[model samples]
Target: MKIEILGTGCSKCKRLEERTNEAVTELGLEAEVVKVEELDQIMEYGVFKTPGLVVDGEVKESGKVPTVKAIKQLLS
Candidate 1:
């Protein structure tokens, strides 16, 4: 699976990225976690907010940093 975290390197964005990595590791899934810092790439996801989570090319969350538990659920 492919997971994308879209943000401009803000605190929330970093948190989301860390949590996402933790979730993936806990699940023992081989996935690519990408941080989309480019404005154009983030806009392509149609997200007007920072800290967006995209899974399999689909936007999963936006505007807030999700907890590790929540991330695990999303990955699952």
Candidate 2:
């Protein structure tokens, strides 16, 4: 699965990234996790807020940092 974390390197963004990775590890899914920092790329996903989560090209969450449990639920 293709998992992308969208952010401009903010604290919340970092937290999301870490939690996403933890979810991926716990799930044992062989997925690629990328950090999208470009404004154009983030806008392309129609997200105006930092710390966005994109899975398989679909925007899942944005604006707030999600907890590990929340991320695991999303990944599942």
Candidate 3:
């Protein structure tokens, strides 16, 4: 699976990334996690929010940081 975290390196963005990593680790899934910092790239996903989560090219969450458990559910 591929997980993408969209943000411009803000605090919330970083937190989302960290939680995503924890989720993936706990799930024991082999996935690639990428940080999308470029505005154009982020806009391509149609997410106007800073913290967005995309799982397998589909936008799952946006605008806020989700907890590790929440992220695990999303990944699942």
Candidate 4:
């Protein structure tokens, strides 16, 4: 599985990245988690918000940081 966190390195974006790591660890799932910091790259996902989550090329969440449990649910 592949995951992407879209943001420009803001505080919330950093938190989301951390939570994503925790979620992946707790789930014992191997996923390539990446941060999309570039504006062009982020825009490609069609997310106007800084914080976004994408799983396997599909947008899952946006505009806010989700809890680790919530991310786990999304991953599942």
lDDT of 2 by residue, 1-76 (tens): 9999999999999999999999999999999999999999999999998889999999999999988999999999
What is the TM-score (0 to 1) of candidate 3? 0.98
Clashing pairs for model 1 are none
Specify the poorest-scoring 10-residue window by lDDT in model 2.
65-74
TM-scores, all models, native as reference: 0.97, 0.97, 0.98, 0.97
- Once superposed on the true structure, which residue ranges of model 4 sit more than 4 Å away at CA? none
Clashing pairs in 2: none
- What is the alpha-carbon lDDT of model 3 when measured against the actual structure? 0.95
lDDT of candidate 4 over 9-42, digit per residue (tens)? 9999999999999999999998999999999999
Off by over 4 Å in 2: none
Candidate 1: tens digits of C-alpha lDDT, residues 5-38 = 9999999999999999999999999999999999
TM-score: model 4 vs. ground truth:
0.97
